[model samples]
Target: MTASLEAKAGIRRHAPAASRHAYVTLVTNDDYARGATALTHSLRHSGTQADIIVLHTPALGEASREALAALGCRLVEADLLPLSDAFNARHARRALHGAAPFTKGRKPDFHTPLDNFVKLRLWQLVEYESCIFVDADAIVLKNIDRLFAYPEFSAAPNVYESLRDFQRLNSGVFVARPALATFAAMQERLDVADAFWPRTDQTFLQTFFPQWHGLPVTFNMLQYVWFTMPDLWDWKSIQVLHFQYEKPWETNHPKSEVLMPLIALWQAFHDGGPIPDIAALPGPSGPAAALSPSAGA
Candidate 1:
């Protein structure tokens, strides 16, 4: 889908030198458009003061593009990432479902946008001193603008813990400082096949920012946490719901019925309505009482 001339120009100038830190996400097509739509909606409802932006590639169909523009959030056009399977940032999320996700995924399409690499592209947005990248597959449960106070490379740990010792932080949510140098550094290392752990950008980020500050577990609540450790996450206490699996969009998803409320909630944002602004979000909730070592750190 082609962006309108006005939107195309607006995308180029959306980030002003005076702008402060902001929230960003990506949308590739109808599937992710739905998620991005809801995400922006929740952000507004939760009272986020920072600018909201949607970074998208040409693969986004015309309808999706116009729909997002109608949301009034800035739309920045991102080039398709050159790396293989790097176009879509959802690979790691898909891997969370099972070793083979093809069976459950949408029918293969001819055009696959480069989404994963866009994560690195965030560094190219030099105008903002900092940014919070919330995966579109999530919804904000409360105002999380206070997270802007944290330093760069801050993120929550992946909710899934394997029998193996290795546990990568979920890129579903993160705070980063966008810089050209960091973007260049990532590109230089992309050629190394082993650069990305488990063949996804989540690991590349972990390797690049090994000393990243940690956000509270409540910042990005994954579906698996509710499935595997319910006590650790209280919906009333959480900030965002990272739709780890069984997304609200898929009619047959196991969590579809229970998570159905999220649809109307997302729609309210998509359709337009009043929501709390940044100043009114619930009191900053602390991490769970028994946060994992990586989580509470």
Candidate 2:
């Protein structure tokens, strides 16, 4: 059966609520395949018992699909045709002169084109009683069974603090329960707000939750040296370590040395060599001489 039909059958056979809180990831592009695999491996390695699913947009060609399938993951092809209007940044952000009643006091707006598709996937998958959304760029360092216990709309602080007034929360990780009313309100705000904030999904999310009730800073730790000094976080105690910037594929980031195991695995796959022992990674040297885009530092 096609993926859609299979998904429908599964949904009917086992209700989302029956599974309660599940964990899901969005990997809309083929380039993100390695990150997706690492995410799944790290999660299972740490003993997460929740359902794990990856949402794929049509752009992921056959090779990408096979690679993901080889990892024994469930895939859902997103309904991109219906979102054609929103898929294109220009049209989606065009100001509508004829204001729809629901858009009162709001202006024509859609978020930056980069990860709006991810926002859509989050909408579709979080219909369960609770759900945890983890960015494909993240790795699970520890078993965070306690994360599921956080209340709806819980997330860690965006270490960067780029947004004003509100402590910007990282969209990279969040724990949410079914809050149909809240989700609807947040979605509407995103669909019609004026183009004034950062062109990032995290900016939209920062506005979604009120300050006092937002999740504590301990949950989703954003790991970027430039955003804040890396030493600020108790790295050993973090629930999720997000490689939010200078990602592994980008080559020669100073912080890449810390995640050498992940970096080396990626290098082995690209070089067609035997996997190197994660422990014996060459002592952080000047960027590898033949720096391929795939060998991000």
Candidate 3:
């Protein structure tokens, strides 16, 4: 931030988008928009100098878009599903999200689940040398600039003990090079894959990069431990706290006691001050809450 436009223009020439590094995420609907905003706010609060990028579908409302823009994030909107016969049947509506072995409320069943795959579009950020993707439903407790030093392809293990597990390489937080060639490769692979196993972008990525480096658990310490075994919770060392279905916005749920404290941190970033009591999100309001288009497109 300098006063001289000529100096700034010179700087921009040196720091073209090709040399940029960023943190990326996505929001296909209003439900996750709030979380994405919090994520951006937290990154800025952590003093990151690199770009904070978000890939969203056109369905996102102006409020959510403005919220992200307010954090100095670069929001790139794109049409995720292209009109082509090359599409994979695995991504078809019925096969989307794969087998729902989890409880009813654990995952989305509608077209909402389909847009989750759009995260793969991250590779299209060809201008970036490398980018770290963090799921919107997460909290960045501290600066994680260290991730930028790791390999172009790296991620923390999922909430599991064995790396061999399908979900062990969590897609929630990862570092990767962004290139058009790689993006095309991913698109081609998706077109040919029988199905996105376990039904998500993580599975597709696991298939593509078998030798990806594994980052330490501190980078993506999940909150699952707190919910399953409250006594064993270790709050001090966490770099990121990921909340899935029952995110911070859903405040009226029965887990208010467990959620409020965690939600407080996100509120602190969102409000730009002391964290207030978290509350349930009201029904979608005004044009910002327009009915989202089907992802089948």
Candidate 4:
């Protein structure tokens, strides 16, 4: 078998056995490929021993794939979910955005609603016993290997603006087990007639596992909490910082001024520079300066 095939089959040429757990992230384009690179750097910086896996679509260029491979990230080519044409049409860029506009923050032009559903392909990776799926736009602040012990379908609540926002789960970071049965089950419920997922994979995953275990918010701390809920912004406790809406890579985006501090943090990881002390990083001025009234997916 080829080297890539052997790795997928859990038969590494050097190691006695491949790690049963891995950190998985997705990249569809060059923008997200940059995010994935930084995420891998941060994961290595945190001293994680598990494998780093980057699942990319065909849209990603060869340069991006080579960059990720240089960082010791196992590359897997993931295809968009095989849904009916009607389902894909419903979630197309313009259609989904028109039906459910993002009033709080501007989603970058490259953000495709259908690309989000590709996350579900993680389930098809049955080679790994367990996996922690973190969004490409997020960086690991601390070693979170302990998350592997957490049960399947465990994710942090979507809390950014207020306590009331905890009603839903955030798929930005979650622990899941790899099982073909589960993958098949998700496909069964994903594309029924008139079936619509407003938040794409986030909504569908939440529905697929209604009784999902709730991880502490610190595990997947959303960037908005820095301003909207400053009281909850404990840098020392945050394990992962997720740039949920406005990515740090964008130049002079709408919320650039407000998110400069967080953006700087992401840049440090992306550039492989000396990371600043998390505890010493300044917090928001106050809750009064809350930028957006609503939370994003």
- In terms of TM-score, the best-performing candidate is 4
Candidates 1 and 4: which is better by TM-score?
4
Deviating ranges (above 4 Å) for candidate 2: 1-18, 80-112, 160-166, 179-183, 211-218, 226-228, 251-297
Model 4's alpha-carbon lDDT is: 0.86
State residue 41's C-alpha deviation in candidate 4, in Å. Answer: 0.8
Q: What is the lDDT of residue 110 in candidate 2?
A: 20
Q: Evaluated with lDDT, which candidate comes out highest?
A: 4
lDDT value for candidate 2? 0.55
> Which portions of model 1 miss their true places by more than 4 Å?
1-18, 84-114, 161-167, 193-196, 257-297
Clashes of 4: 0
Q: Give the candidate order by descending TM-score.
A: 4, 3, 1, 2
Q: After superposition, how far is residue 295 of candidate 3 from its true place, in Å?
A: 32
lDDT comparison, 2 vs 3, better candidate: 3
Structure candidate 1, residue pairs in collision: 47-277, 47-278, 87-114, 87-115, 88-115
Give candidates' CA RMSD values in order.
7.7, 8.7, 10.0, 3.8
**Tens-digit lDDT string for candidate 2 (122-156):** 55544466677787767666677676787766777
Q: Which residue runs of candidate 3 sit more than 4 Å off their true CA positions?
A: 1-19, 83-98, 108-111, 160-167, 229-232, 251-254, 275-297
User: Better model by lDDT, 3 or 4?
Assistant: 4
TM-score of each: 0.74, 0.66, 0.77, 0.91
Clashes of each: 5, 6, 1, 0
Q: Cα miss at 211, model 3 (Å)? A: 1.3
Give a tens-digit lDDT track for model 3, residues 91-135: 555555444443422443313655767787787667777788998
